[model samples]
Every structure is written in structure tokens, then in C-alpha cells.
Target: MRLALAQLEIESAAVEDNRERAEAAVAEAADRGADLVALPEIFNVGYFAFDAYQRAAEPVEGPTLSRIADAAREHGIGVLAGSIVEDLAETESVETPADEGLANTSVLFDRDGRRLAVYRKHHLFGYESAEARMLVPGESLGVAEFEGATVGMTTCYDLRFPELYRDIAAEGADLILVPSAWPYPRVEHWQLLPRARAVENQLFVAAINGSGEFDDAELLGRSTVYDPWGTTLAGTGDDPDLVVTDVDLDRVAAVREEFPAWRDRRL
Candidate 1:
């Protein structure tokens, strides 16, 4: 299938503007005959716009994901709407309507606008401060079959966990998708980790990251795609551009057939 990754800038809690841009990018991808489009994580609110989470968080059925769903249906293309500040359903005890289940959630919409899956970030990044304190960690790993490939879902910090990818692969995922807001000073890790995962797991790894500078941090935008043989099929630097590429599922079979490493694994 032909896949396009939209790596762009977020407007720091500006939902409408980011939605418009995301719509435009989806349209562009559709015009190019893409089967699926993957967007950057938290494009509505900048990654470092931590202060705006409370004000900008929306429910799963809210306008943010609904907009992407509408766009996906309109274009007759699949969409991997990046992470959004999710406002969960109202609880019994909490009086404040504002205090909903706030999670960093990623939603996938099929060509018909039906939601395929909603994967929240299982691993929260709290290295410097406390992302876990603010957001709720996900309970389940996401997996789905789309465009003839088994797709696995993950967020920014989940890249550090190899077990997640291994579990996805064991569950029959040939391509693992990571929607991230990974920052700089550790750009080397960003580059190395995904490729290493691809090499080690013998599967395709696709990372879609944000570009441009946030409030106090700058995301290293190197949205990329790797083949099953651990070769760079397509990649971009720290710039906001759509990285589009076509990957055949047959390649995975061919590589595994030739190497036969997975069959010999004792673990």
C-alpha cells in the first residue's frame, strides 16, 4: 500500500488552525493516490504545550478526531490521526466538568470514516518533569489489519520499549507505526532506536514525528520508513514535509523466507 507521513508544526493549543492544516495534508495525500496517511502526534497542541492540556483536551468523539474522520471519509482514504489530548467520559465523584479522563490518544479512521482503533500512549514520558502525573497511561496495545498489513500502534516514549514491538510482531504485525513528539539533544536515539527495532524484529518500522520548535523544546522531525530488511526506504530531516512511500506486503514474506531468522528463534 502507498503510505504518506505528514510531519508538520503544531500551533500550540490552536485546534482550528491545526485541523485545517491536517485536512489540507490529507487532501494532498489523497490527491497523490495514497492508501493511508499518518499524521504527527498532538498536532493540535504543540508537544511542549503541556500547560494547555487542561484547556484543549477533547473527548474521543469530540471535534478534533471527528474532523479527521470527516476528512478521511471525504477523501476516501485511511487516516492515522495523531495523538490528541483526550477528555474521557464524566465520572460520578468529580464535580468539575473539566476533569475528564485526559489521555494522549491516537485514533485511526478508515476510508468510510469508521474508527478502527483508539490507542492511548501506554508509556508516558516523565524524564524531566511528570508527564505521567498529567496523562493517563493506556491499558491495551493496539493492533489492526489495514490495507493488507497488520499495523501496530505506539506513541513517543513507547519507542524506548522493545517489548512493545516484539509483542506487536508476535501478534502478526508486519509494520509498526509510531506517532511521536520526540525532542532534540537525543536525536541520535530517535534515529537509532526505530532502525534497531526494524533490524532486530525483521519488520517494517514507520515513525511519524512533529517538526518546528515548541514552547521550551524542539522536536527532532525525522519522520521515516524502513523496509523489512532494515533499509531506509524513505526519510526526512528536521523539516516539515510529507514523506510518502509504497510498501508491498510481499517484501516481508520475501525477507523472512530468505533469512529464516524468526523460525530459528528460541526465545
Candidate 2:
């Protein structure tokens, strides 16, 4: 499968402009024959733009996702519409009544614009940030099939937790998509974690991060794709870029069979 990672430059609270840029990136990726296109975390509203979270938050079927679905159908390619600030109160899908909370959510759409899976971030960041206090944590893992690959979804802070990736892999995921808004001063950790996940889980990991500054933080936009063997297939620098690369889904099986480490695991 050919995957496109869009490292978009996000501006704080500029929802419309960000959506337009994301759509254009999807179109460009599709034109280049990308089977799937993924965007960075909170591409519409900057992650550190905490003040805009409530105002920009919307339901699962809000205009943000609708526009992304249109792009997916228009290009005939699957899309991972990164993470969004979801207003739980505005949504009709969930049963419980959390009348005053929001969740950080990621959505997946098929080539024909069919909704595949939705992943709300389980691990909310709190390192000098207010995500934990502002958003309600998600309760489940996300996995789905697309173009002969079992894809999984996780957000930025989720990368720090290997058990989460293992759980998703247990649910039959071979390709993991991570939408992140990771900031600077920790680029080392950013680079190390994804590769570690790919190698340990024996699955492909594609990490898509954003570029640009927010308040007092700046994103380290080194979006990367790793094969099962922890080999870097494609990566971008600390800039806004569209990194496209081909991946062999069958390699996952091949690597597992050749290494056989997963079978040796014990309690």
C-alpha cells in the first residue's frame, strides 16, 4: 500500500483554513496514487490552542469530518482524519450523558467515504498541558481493515504507552497510524518511541506529526514510517511536508514468521 503522511502547518484556532489545507493535501496525495492519506493531530485547531478547544469542538459527524469524507470519496482513497476535539455533549452516537466534556478523537474513512473506525485518545497529556483536565478519556481501542491491511489508530500521547499498541495489535492490526502534535525539546523521545513500537509489536507504524508553533511550544515535524523490522521507509524533517512511500503489507507476516518473537512471549 502507498501511504501519504501530511505534516501540515497548523495555525491556532484557524479551523476553516486548516481544513482547506488538509483537503488539498489529501487531493495531492491521491493524485500521486496514495492508497491512504493521514493527517496530523488536531489539524483544524492547534493542540496547544487550549482556549479554542471548547469553541471548535464538534460532534463525530461534524463539518470537519464531512469535508474529509468528501475528500476521501473524491480521490477514491482511504483517509485518517487525525485527531479532533470532539464535543461529547453534541453527539448522538454515544448513550451516556457527559453534558460538559469533550474527547480527543480520530476518525477513519474508506475509499468510498464509508466510516470505518473512530479512536478517541485514551491517554490525555498533562505535562505542563491541560488535556487531562479538559478532555474526557476514550474507553476503547480502534482497528479496521483497508486495502488488504488491518489498520489501527492512536493519538500523540498514546505513543508513550506500549501496552496500548499491543492491545490494538491483539485486535488484529498490522498497520498502526499515529496522529500527533508532539512539541520540541523532546525530539529524541519522539523519534525513539515509534520505532520501538514497530519493532516490538512486529507491525508497521506510521507516525504523522504537525509543523508550526503554538503559544510557547513548537511541533517537531519529523513524521516517520517504519516497517516491521523497524526500518525507516520514509520520513520528513522539521517542516511542513507530504511524505509518501510504498509499504508491503505481506512483510508483516513474513517478519513474524522469520523472527518468531511474538510466539515466545509469556505472562
Candidate 3:
């Protein structure tokens, strides 16, 4: 499968501008022959924009995801609508983690614009941030069958937890998409975690981060895709970019068979 990771230029609290850029990226990726395109976390509202979280929060089927679903259908390519600040109370279409609160959420759409999965971020960042206090944690894992592969979704801070990836791997996931808003100074961690998850889980791990700056933080772009063998197939520096790469779905099984480390897990 051909995958495109969109490292978008996100501006704090600029909902309309961010959404436009995300849609444009999807169109460009489709034109570039991508079968699927994944976006960064909170592409609609910048992740560091804590004050705007409440105002920008929308339901799973709201305007942001609705436009993304339309773009997927128009382009005839699958899309992982990176993520948004979801207003759980207003969302009646899906089962929310909380009845009346905000959550970090992502939605997946097929080429026909069908809602395939909704993944609220399981892990909320707490270190020097307001995300944990402002959002409700996701209670379920997001996995779906798309094209010829099983895809899983996770957010930024979730990369630090390998157990989540292992659980998804147990669910027969072949590829995992990480929608992140990772910042500067921790470039090494951003680089290490996703590759490790790919190697240990014997699956593709694509870490998609955004670009641009906020008042207190600046997004460190560096969106990357790793094969089952932990090889960097495609990547970019700290800038808005479209990182596309072809991945063989069969590689997951081949790597697992060769290493057999996943099967030996006693814990």
C-alpha cells in the first residue's frame, strides 16, 4: 500500500486555515498516487492552543471530519482524519468515553467516505500541558480493516506506551498510524519510540507530526514511516511536508516469522 504522511503547518486557534491545509494535503497526496493519507494530531486546532480547545471541540460527525470524509470520497483515497478536540456530549453517533466532556479523537474514512473507526486518544499528555486536565481519556482501541491490511490508530503520547501497540498487534494489526503533535527538544524520543514499536510489534509504524509554532511551543515536524524491520522508508525534517512511501502488507508476517519474538511473549 502507498501511504502518505502529511506534516501540516498548523496555526494556533486557526480552525478554518488548518482545516483547509489538511484538505489540500489530502488532495495532493491522492494526486501523488497515495492509497491512504494520514494527518497529524489536532490538525484543526493546534495542540498547544489550550484555551481554544473548548471552542474548537466538535462531534465525530461534525464539520471537520465531515469535510475530511468528503475529501476521501472525492479523491478516492482512504483518510485518517488525524484528530480533533471532540465534544463527547454532542456526539450521538458513536459511544463516547465520557458523556459530557472533551476528548482527543480521530476518525477513519474509506475511499467511499464510510466511517470505519473512531479512535479517541488513549494516553493524554500531562507534562507541562493542559491536555490531561482538559480531556477525557479514550477507553477503547481503534482498529480497522482497510484495503489489504489491518490498520490501527494511536496519538502522540501513546507512543511512549508499548503495551498499547502490543494490544493492537494482538488484534492482528499490520500497520499503526500515530497522529502526533510532538515538539522540540525531544526529537530523539520522537524518533525512537515509533521505530521501537514497529520492530517489537512486527508492523508498520507511521509517526505523523505537524509543523509551525504556538505561543509556548513549536511543533517539531519530522514525520516518518518505519517498516516492520524498523527501517525508515520515508521521512522529513521539521517542516511542512508530504512523506509518502510504499509498504508491503506481507512484510509484517515475514518479519514476525523470521524473528518469532512476538510469539515468545510470556507476559
On lDDT, the stronger of 1 and 3 is 3
Candidate 1 versus the native: TM-score? 0.94
Per-residue lDDT of candidate 3, residues 1-267 (tens digit):
999999999999999999999999999999999999999999999999999999999998899999999999999999999899999999998988778999999998999989999999998899999999999999899999998789999999999999999999999999999999999989999999999999989899999999999998989999999999899999999989999999899988888889999888898
Clashing pairs in 1: none
Q: Alpha carbon lDDT of residue 69, candidate 2?
A: 94
For model 2, residues 1-267, the per-residue Cα lDDT tens digits are 999999999999999999999999999999999999999999999999999999999998899988999999999999999988999888776442366599998899999988898888999999999999999988878899887789999999999999999999888888999999999999999999999999999999999999999889999999999999999999989999999999999999899999998777884
Q: What's each prediction's clash count?
A: 0, 0, 0
Once fitted onto the true fold, the runs of candidate 1 whose alpha carbons sit more than 4 angstroms away are: 90-100
Best-fitting candidate, measured by TM-score? 3
Give the poorly placed runs of model 2, Cα more than 4 Å off.
94-100
Task: Rank candidates, lDDT, best first.
Answer: 3, 2, 1
Q: Rate the local accuracy (lDDT) of all candidates.
A: 0.84, 0.92, 0.95
Best by lDDT: 3
Clashing pairs in 2: none
lDDT of 1 at 50: 84
